[model samples]
Target: MKITSIIIALSFISACRGLNMTRLRPYDLTAELMFIFEDIDQNGIMTVFEFETVFDRYDSNVDGRVTRSVYTTYICKSDPVQYELSHYLFDEYDVDGDHFLDYHDYDNFYNKMDTSADGLVVKTEFVNYWVLLFQKYENSDIHPMSTLCR
Candidate 1:
């Protein structure tokens, strides 16, 4: 069936090594963000290990969670420095509405990336999420995600 072929192709792509981000057509900004965060080894892959590494770095309290302060700091450091830049990025990632980005929020983000519900996000799933995000931006005039992506 066509579904089977798609699955096989996705698996093959995920299994392949390294990601040439610059070569991704249409310029995927979400993938660029993930590449900055989840590609710890810089091998063009977003494994759980890499994901955790980035999160742990942001979890500055050493409490295994990320607070708004920490998340904002990370974004400010990565993104172009701007007035209240960290505030906007922190607001975006604070999913619990608790005014903080905790382990639960982190889990939610990873869950979003784990499209197959397999508790792990392969390269395909990671890129797919970025693609979807990119599309959402393309369809809208607002540039909130654009600021984050940039």
Candidate 2:
């Protein structure tokens, strides 16, 4: 679709209902956003190992999978405010058809979200990765997704 058409569609969609809008990020070379990763280790890369560490921490049954129940458990225990963040991230990032995120899914999404087309993403991309799930990110929430909860 053309840019104008996309804008028109967005306008129409916005007119119909609410969009849980997030603030637009600043430029690529910002001082703070460049440093905002969760950084499970000091590795400086959002590697599979790092993601798995976080993922495992949240998986309640040692199942190595973040099912809905696992996700809820993590949200309630870790960051309740953004408990939905895992759902948002998993819904979009689990692209491998495995029903859960292994290294491949996480790696692909991590790379794509590296929007500068650069080899590495800065702090902001990690934060905004799930927040922009429907638009430039792709309408994938576990391969079948809803644009919103309500």
Candidate 3:
């Protein structure tokens, strides 16, 4: 099942690029994966409850923390494409320069999503992050993920 999800994600990336090259409005593959991997309830939105559940799953050994290894393993199991893309995103989560993601790191991330500061991340806010990331991919070439996006 994990491999199948990766294959589908890669397919989406390739298909989107093809459409983009043709000057068409392409699909957003990252947003698709966000929904697939993070939307625990599959209700088309990631509530706080679902996000906490995912956080606990990645916090192996119930230590209330997530190391790079644990996060990489979780991404590999959830979506291989994301596993490959992890290098581009790891530093974003490893707050405090400790090379691990703890509750504080997660809180920082959630704060970024909680644009209204209402303590909740609706579907639009969550999906828009990926959308903006992909748009940034179009303007920059320094990042490895940008290369793939093109």
Candidate 4:
């Protein structure tokens, strides 16, 4: 579930100075979160606050908590190519390595998709996820779901 590309990018940082690493791009919020996410390694260090009451704030279903089906449904309904993403998600989200996707599996998947340093997937991150869900889509002219994604 770690965006392998981004994780590898983190590993390549040559700078280890205190708060002044070469990876620190002054205009790059994404890099900063990557640093914290790498440090936590469990997604705990970057989590910013407590918002358990805000259902679908992260978990869109308002089902009290996020589950795999809810998230996958979101992805499927939004991905530019729905069919392809269904299989892609199945491959990535089966966290037990058992090939069965579930809530626990999705916990890891959802966290990885939360690209922001804020620890929560606000609308913007959802859009980012869609764009990333199919990197090839970036070249297409599809209009992203602005109201939904962000």
Top candidate, metric lDDT: 3
lDDT of 2 by residue, 24-98 (tens): 223232223333444655555555456556656766667555665555556557554333344655666678656
Stretches > 4 Å off in candidate 2: 1-37, 42-45, 84-86, 115-120, 127-131, 134-150
lDDT tens digits, residue span 1-150, model 4: 569977876755522211222222232354344334333334433232322221233367444444545545665565423422343445666667664544566566658757664556554454455445455332333232212221
- CA RMSD (A), model 4: 15.8
lDDT (C-alpha, whole model) for all candidates: 0.60, 0.52, 0.65, 0.44
Most TM-score-accurate candidate = 3
| lDDT of candidate 3 over 1-150, digit per residue (tens) | 999999999988776543132221242555666667787777766666777787888887998888877777776676555444454456676768798888878777777877877877777787777666555444332334333321
Clashing pairs in 1: none
lDDT, model 1: 0.60
Per-residue lDDT of 1-150 in model 1, one digit per residue for the tens? 999999999977754422223233454554666566667676765666667777788877687767665566566576433213345445555787887677667677778888888877777777787677444433223223323423
Clashes of each: 0, 2, 0, 1
- CA RMSD, predictions in order: 14.1, 8.3, 10.0, 15.8
Task: Summing lDDT over every window of 10 consecutive residues in candidate 4, give the lowest-scoring window.
Answer: 16-25
Query: Model 4, which residues run further than 4 Å from truth?
Result: 1-81, 136-150
- Cα lDDT of candidate 3 equals 0.65
Off by over 4 Å in 1: 1-25, 29-33, 41-47, 81-89, 135-150
Candidate 2 whole-model C-alpha lDDT, 0 to 1: 0.52
In angstroms, give how far residue 91 of model 3 lies from its true place: 0.9
